[model samples]
Target: MKNTTISDLKIIQIDKIKEERGTLSVIEKDVVPFQLKRVYYLYDVPSDAYRGGHAHKELYQFLIPVSGSFDVILNDGYNTKTITLNKPDKGLLIVPGIWRELENFSSGSVCLVLASEVYDEDDYIRDFELFKTLKTT
Candidate 1:
């Protein structure tokens, strides 16, 4: 397999609509490169707590911090990059075959994730070494 880098990642701007009721941010299905299969959010994360210590083999995920802020550390078994997500209308697209970890979550941070696939244990590469191997070939 060819190596992937941070350059392959994308920052997607979610459309925000302001109304008398409240601000609305949306993740439209056709707006993204991939179709949405699963949607999950992380909330009530403590300052020291961390999430996402694995990489997906065939799944893609777009992460957005709907509230507060956090850093998404991405590694492709070669180079590493960190992208911060603090806005509800901004998303970080994490491609497959890239090792990712979410850290430095601020108080009351809510991270919303849009996935390309549903829950499948076999699609995940949880070990760093295995991810590295898979990233190379």
Candidate 2:
């Protein structure tokens, strides 16, 4: 597996239009800076939750806050970074081999994830220590 670094993570904001009645958000394919193949939304979750404690080997994902706010903790073996996603038009792009944990979900928070590939268990590196060794050596 190729080594992944923290620089691979990218934060991007989508286009949002606000009106008197409501708002509209748009996320286009090529405009997102990455090719989107799969789309999923996370909702109906509890507060101060812990989710996504694994790392992918080949799948690249972009997390966006659609409704409310949330915090995404990313660990790339040596360093850990915390990103807050509160805007409906903003997103964080996470590459493979980086472990991610999502927490501190606000009320009625909807997180949308756009993946580069389909689900594959073989692509995951669940152990943090092993991931560190693999990245360093």
Which residue pairs collide in model 2, if any? 14-89
lDDT of 1 by residue, 69-137 (tens): 999989988899988889888889888888898989999899988899999998888889978877777
Clashes of each: 0, 1
Which 10 consecutive positions of candidate 1 have the poorest summed lDDT? 1-10
Q: Candidate 2's residue-wise lDDT over 20-134, tens digit each? A: 9898988875756657778999997789677899888788898989889989999888889999999887889888889899999999999999888777789888887887888
Best candidate, lDDT:
1
Error of 2 at 22 (Å): 2.3
